[model samples]
Target chain A: MRFTSLSGLALGLALSSTAAFAGEIVLNSDQSDPAPKKAMEELIANFQAANPGITVKWNNFDHEGYKSAINNFLKANPPDVAAWYAGNRMAPQVKAGLFEDVTDVWEKNGLNDQLKSAAPSMTIDGKKWGVPYTYYQWGIYYRPDVFKANGVNVPKNWAELVAACAKLKAAGIAPFAIGSSQKWPTGGWFDYMDLRVNGYQFHMDLTGGKVAWTDPKVKAVFDKWAELVKPGYYIENAAALDWQDAIPQFASGKAAMYLMGNFAVAPMMKAGLKEDQLDFMQFPEITAGIPMAEDAPTDTFHIPSGAKNKDDAKKFLAFVASADAQTKLNATLGQLPVNSGSAKPDDKFLKAGFAMLSSAAGLAQFFDRDAPAEMASAGMDGFQEFMVHPDHQDAILARLEAVRAKAYK
Target chain B: MSAIAAQPDAPLAASWWKRNQLQLAPWLFLAPGIFAFAVYVMIPIVQSVSLSFYEWDGLTPDAKWVGFGNYTELWTDPDFWTSLRNNVAWLVMYLLAVPAGLAVALFLNQNVTGIRVYKSLFFFPFVISQVVVGLMFRWFYAPNFGLLSGVIKTLTGSNIAILADDRYATYGIIAAGLWPQIAYCMILYLTGLNNINSEQVEAARMDGARGWKLLWNIILPQLAPATFIAVVVTVIGALRSFDLVSIMTKGGPYGSTRVLSYYMYEKALSEYGFRMGYGAAIAVVLFLIMMVFITYFILQMLRQERDA
Candidate 1:
């Protein structure tokens, strides 16, 4: 018994000494999808190759499970680095002081200049809380073949879009294929309309709950939505289908256009649509002088406040921010690199997306990410309700205004 | 325990403890299970009750005391009322499972050829998980290409999206829930029917009791224990209807299918609101509802025990 006890004590000491000497960074990521998981693996391989002395232990979690798992782990036993979203999703963590400020890493590595587009989003109270590695642009993904068949030129303004929709309707095709059953697809529509009609500032204020849902500006945005909805531009019984379920309608030539993120390209291709057949376009100009803003939900990595290996964590963040690193990672991810100096993707769709996002006046992290979750849910519900029953717009707006008042307060 | 120590010098305390050992042994056997239940179940329930009186976002450590605030807010919340109404609908509609199960049991009780296989096949839905059951029902209720929609279109010349329509979504989900619940109730009655007092049934038939009269006067009273258990479990299942609703609609189509349990989950955990305090208040309300039934059940049992 004494010998066993003595050996246990010796083993514990040896383990402790090794732990104290060898630098280890624990990373928690929600990149369980095949493409992004491969990207993460390659990123860690390069990071380890660069820093031979440091070891990164990665804990991967499924997308839905990670949202709930994050709070428990961050408080009880936090990882050195964790993947999270930007904008209001990260705001709560920053406010709670759960995320470590990495402004110094950004300054020393010139990340502020390289990752310029995402810098404002990662900043909280003039300090950077995280390093964003990737983001994708949301736009109108349509069939060029369908446009040619209908004699519809790519819409350049609101009038052109309306005319194009009318032409498409005459040609026996709905203009948009949307599935608002899940409701986030409806959020994308609302985000774009608010961004186009009222510009980025109004979009931000409305999502931030600084503007009431009953505001006339908010009503005007809904009025534009009602025009398409009332005219039956979307698929019938759209609320019954999921986003993926709606993709089939667009791919089968039943629908002409889809307003979605760049990720839809893979599924669209898989559904037997050729790369040349499909095209990406910026949403048509709505208000002439407002410039253009887009939804670019950025994925980022941050050091938890309770992280043990701060130095190694900072090194990883710096590496993630580097243009070379981001370029390599985004190549595997099929997403745009957050770093501005990174090489533009060679894919035709991504090439178009990059150009559109690079020239955007601002980026609003999609409506759900910009607003608090409760308000976003209520707002999306209102949007869906408006879509199904546009006549009851006032009642829906009143309900939303009530929820916003309680949620924001 | 050890032959009562077998001597006078074994000490009086040992003898006394040993004398009372049979009485103590049953309690000693129950102690571990009782302790586990107290720790895991009772403690969390008490904690949740206390938590209802505070404002907690479920993440940060800084929880503010806000007595009765969450409850008062829930009183005016439309979502809360929607969930409550759906829960009532579920309770009323789910009772249909009991009578439906009885009908199926009666049909399948005969000793026909290959009856065992048919019975097993009918029991298949109950054997599978609720998640799979929900998915199967989702495909069945899918709007455009679903089997049910295809049938509706063929007959009525118009397809009805039951899961999408606000008026029918709850009923659609409840109907899915009934598939498995009816199978469960049928199995219970099947077992009860197997061990029935045959002599009493035979005597009742001889005394001019036939068909419906035979079933009402004879068989049902004998299956009282089975019926009681089925009602208890069905009531509990109705109240805790979360999985099917979650997998089917997620309280969507304007939150029309929201039930108390699903609403509580949304409030506490979902992307919508992590209002843990408010969720706990909702849970306390559900617990009170369950407690009403539980106390009634226990009181009934006690009264029966006295009569017996």
Candidate 2:
């Protein structure tokens, strides 16, 4: 009797939610982490308060499952508002007409200027696909004390970086700590390398498949990476470890530096590094006279084209794009807000990231976001092979070139 | 007379169910099962084969038919060949588990004290989930602090991450798979041993055929059915080696450890793989490869059934 009653109540509730009224907007996002979830709840409550008549229904997904879930849900039962990343990751959705155009919202609400840094990534054919709210900077996170002990200054260019790595190697420490098992961590490294070596436009073009992987400029970037890889500067057996597993090496003084996003700062701190010991530096420049470009992969919200409540979804997107909401949301997220009008973050690591990003010549959504999924997948695997065997450069590049030919089409 | 119920045999017509109840009742009982099979298994396979001839992103309704396009692409795809090569390697290496299992089972067949405890302890790996076995073995082969690497380091002052090295990764996963598979084969042989005719064994023992001679001539022939079962299960398990590969390596180190099933998933369902038509093509190939072995197994079973 109890089971039937309970199931009846559940069934009723489910039906009620499905049969939404005119005032309701169904939102779907992946904010499953504790802090993000709290922030999302607060954001929704605030939105509801501001627009009293509009009631927002939110559905949250765990990070990994949400990737595939978005594809299915958007095609079948699209929520009014959906969370997604910027750049080529969104390109497929836009091309398939699964995502609704929000250019008018951006123009009318003045988001084009407030979210200026993320506009290029959001735009395809001069129209915006999503509203970006939060992003984080990726650079070299290093142990300052280890650099001091080895008598190495923070490297500013390729030569100095190589010399610094040599000093660290001689001091019986791995110069770099990386875990390539999941492959995204390697993507961060490759993005910084390609950006610094060939500069942003060429790097984007290469990932976008306009420039061939067999091109000499692409080879030059690998040759630059080889300087560190060939010398055994990276922690041994990195390919077997996940990104979190490699953190212990940095914390325990086994490795001296890590190239990762600002999200890594909290975990590194949790791993027992004092604030003074851990420091951030912009990735060292590879080519002379190239403008510095930093990677900042943005998380955005879009109105799925199949949405039933387009008007309400647009309102939600505008509210999220606003500076006030962004400042509070990013503080909870412990990351950088996409809105330039938002106040500077309180955390020291975020402050450094914010400052570096402000001066960057251009910002790139990382390799995975900049390149299509198939290309990113093949490219990152190729990157791991190159990292392990620098001597296999030609063959690896040739293989990637072959994939690039097919992937772009 | 109400037309005498329209016929002389009206009473017999009313009792028709009673006449054919045995056959009709069985069909009625099997209806649900047959419907489920048609909906779930047989229909999906036919759909998948047809789907392989199209080009679909799995996002849109537009699926352009391109006959032989995906298959032709697969012919040149290096990753496909790599997956096929690794699957062949898995089949050969996995078969070694049968002999290993028989050896362990034979040794345990003797009358000993607390033998049930021994048997249960040996059977433990088979009972544990494949996911747990994969995890345990992954850690066992992990670098820097893992058991095998730690031992290797202490002895040679060099540590090797087996799963990180493409050449050794598949072997490492296979070793892990064998741990449980061997236990399964051992259980099957144990049950076979319990049912073997005791009179023949006793007669052979009395004839002074006390060693390998008696085991080979008498015991082995009786264990033929058990061996047959073990081979069949092992072959299916080998081909269905997706879970261990997924758990242990995820077809990584640049996909060097990918077998057919993992590769099929990588091409079809993975984050980068929404090319449904391409994925379907890979699936069809895997199904065809499986059919070759499945056909042989079925023929062998039919022959055995007829002989009996």
- The residue pairs that clash in candidate 2, if any, are none
Per-residue error for A407 in candidate 1, Å, reads: 1.7
Give candidate 1 regions above 4 Å deviation. A1-24, A53-55, B1-10, B13-27
- For candidate 1, lDDT tens digit of each residue in A1-409? 9999999999999988775556989999998877889999999999988977688899999976787678778888999999999988887678778999999999999988988878888998999999999999899999999999889999999889988999999889989998878888899999999999999989999999999889999899889888898998888788889888999999998899999988788778888899878999999888889989999999999999999989889999999999999999999888999998889899888888888887999999998889987888888888887888899899999999999887885
> CA lDDT of B24 in candidate 1?
95
Q: Please write out the lDDT profile of model 2 over residues B115-152, one tens digit for every residue.
A: 99999899999999999999999899999778999998
* Per-model B-chain TM-score: 0.94, 0.94
How far in Å is the alpha carbon of A137 misplaced in model 2?
Answer: 1.1
Model 2 segments more than 4 A misplaced: A1-27, A32-38, A48-60, A306-312, B1-5, B9-29, B110-113
Instruction: Predict model 1's lDDT versus the native.
Output: 0.90
Alpha carbon lDDT at B234, candidate 1: 92
RMSD of 1: 4.9
